[model samples]
Target: MPRTKGNHEARRRDVSEAVWRVLVAHGFGGLTMRAVAAELDATTGLLTHYFPAKRDLVAYALDLLERRSASRPRRAAGKGLSAVRAALLDILPLTDEATDSNRIWVSSWDAALANPELSDDYARKYAKSREKLRDLVAAAQQLGELPDGDPARIAAGAQSFVLGLVVQALFDPPAFPSHRQAELLDDYLATLNSPPSSGGDHEILS
Candidate 1:
């Protein structure tokens, strides 16, 4: 029997779904050709038809993760500090879906560190995320909602805080529930709104 274009497309979709399932269950560390094959109930030979090497498979999975992250619903648009808060909150693992995604993202760090190409890709992705936060921080400063300082520095700090929170939440779900996470984020943001001291040390915010 000859395979038609539709059949090939359907098979590709099945492969993608299988890859996602493997990622969610095992993270990148467990993302092997054998694991994906087991999830799909297919053979490694079939995966090889699509991805010739382990790196190829890993790269595809990473790209798939990025697409999923981008397509997920974002917080409603706003301005100033409110918008900054919304953007930061959107990154938290507040929902089950987000928790799973964050777990996969965290797991990818080891792989990214080992591979120079993947390391570069992750660096660019983080830079882009920081750039978005920086713009929002600059807007908030312009509106006088936040203290005067370097927007880029503030944004980097915010990103670091959120990522650290994410790891904590992932490790201790009982301790860092969604509401607690939100409250902590609010507390952090509130500090930014404080007026500068007589000492004029912007490092307080940084």
Candidate 2:
């Protein structure tokens, strides 16, 4: 039977999803084409028709993960610090789905270490993500929910904290449960949301 372009693309999408499942089940180390094929109950030959190399399959899986991360539903939480908090919470591994995504993301960091292209791409992505966090902090300050501070520094610190928290949540889920992570994040943000200082130069954290 002749394969149409539409069918081919559909098959590629299925293969990519299988890759995601493999990643979720076994992390990056288990994302081989054969493993994905096994997850799909298909053959390696079929996957090879879509992804010639393992790197291509891995890259496509990462791209799909990023798209899924961006498409998560986010609440407005009104304006001011609440808005910033809402945005930050949306990035955490709060849900089962989010936990899987975070696990894959953490595993991908190691994979990216050997793949310069993926590393550079993620570097840009992380920077953009941090910029959004920075903007949220600045917006909260402008709305008088937070004290005046270097928005860039605040955002950078927040980003660093979130990254570390995510790792802990992934590996030590018992200790850093979702609610605990939220409590810590909210508590830290609360410290920054003090009454605006007269000097207008208060640091984000003491």
Candidate 3:
């Protein structure tokens, strides 16, 4: 008898779980077919049936990461700068799970930078994230919570700050614990409240 759609979906979920385990344990560099097979306690043939090539598996893994990130719980919805702060905090590696996810993302950078298609894909993802942040920044400015400036530029700066902090926290967790990360983020946000310098609104390249 032919398998039902539910069966196919269950099998895919199983595969995705196995892939996530492998990614969290060893990053993309160690995401071999054998490793995933062992993680799933299944044969390589099974994986090959789902992913004919290693690249296919890698692509699926990346997609899984994006899906998981999008589904993560967000802080209570608010408006203006408070909402912006909540959104930015969600990106920081302040929890164990967030730290692991950040590690996986940082590990994927090498693979993404090497392949043109993956590079473009990552670029688009970052752009989309920045766009969301830009909207928040614009709202905050409108509410007088932040000083006037180009929302896109402000958003880009915020994104860069969060990402840089993520890298630092990943590399030196001892130096940048969760509280420290939050404190630093608050400090950065505080600066946004300052009026633009007399010279002019400082140019911030997006």
Candidate 4:
């Protein structure tokens, strides 16, 4: 008998979680249906039941990572600037789970450079994340909580700074602690609130 779609989806979630475990513990190259099946104590047939193709598995994993990555920050939206900062930190690869997700994303982005098929998805997600940050910064500005900088540019710059922090953590361990990150975020927010130069047109919101 043909299985129902919901059943497949349920299994897909299970399989996806298993894949996350493997990808976190090992890299993408180390991921396999067999490994995931064993991790879940299931069979390859069952794993295939959810993720029949490796690409399907990768796509699912990426979607999960993106959704989970964005959730916290979005929730923190109404709380205030501090909430927004907290959300941004949730996206970084500092902790074990975040590190795994970030590792997969970074590696996938590198692979996308040579793989035309994956480039669009990578670019789309990257742009969306940047836009989200921009929006959050704009919100802060609208509240008159931030200083006199251009929100668009300031948001982009802030995103760049956070990205640098994350990349630095990957290269140099023990330097991206949460408390330090919070301080860095506060510093960045303070910069955004700085005075704009004289006679500058700063009504832009892109």
Each model's lDDT: 0.92, 0.84, 0.93, 0.70
In model 3, how many backbone clashes occur? 0
> Which candidate, 2 or 3, has the higher lDDT?
3
Model 1: what TM-score? 0.91
What is the C-alpha lDDT profile of model 1 across 1-206, one tens digit per residue?
46999999898899889998898899998899999999889899988999999989998999988998999898996899999999999999999999988988998899999989889989999999999999999999999889999999999999999999999999999999999999999999988787756664666655
Candidate 4's residue-wise lDDT over 1-206, tens digit each?
A: 46799977876677667877887776666678788889889888877767789877767766776676665333344654665576567666657666666776665565577778678877786677778777776777677766645666766777778777777766565777766766777787676667755553565532
TM-score of 4: 0.73
lDDT of 4: 0.70
Q: Candidate 4 — which residues are off by over 4 angstroms?
A: 1-11, 70-75, 78-84, 94-96, 171-173, 196-206
RMSD list, candidates in order = 2.5, 3.6, 3.3, 5.4
Least well predicted 10-residue stretch by lDDT in candidate 2:
196-205
lDDT of 1 at 50: 90
User: Residue 162 deviation, candidate 2, in Å?
Assistant: 1.3
Better of 1 and 2 by TM-score: 1
TM-score of each: 0.91, 0.87, 0.90, 0.73
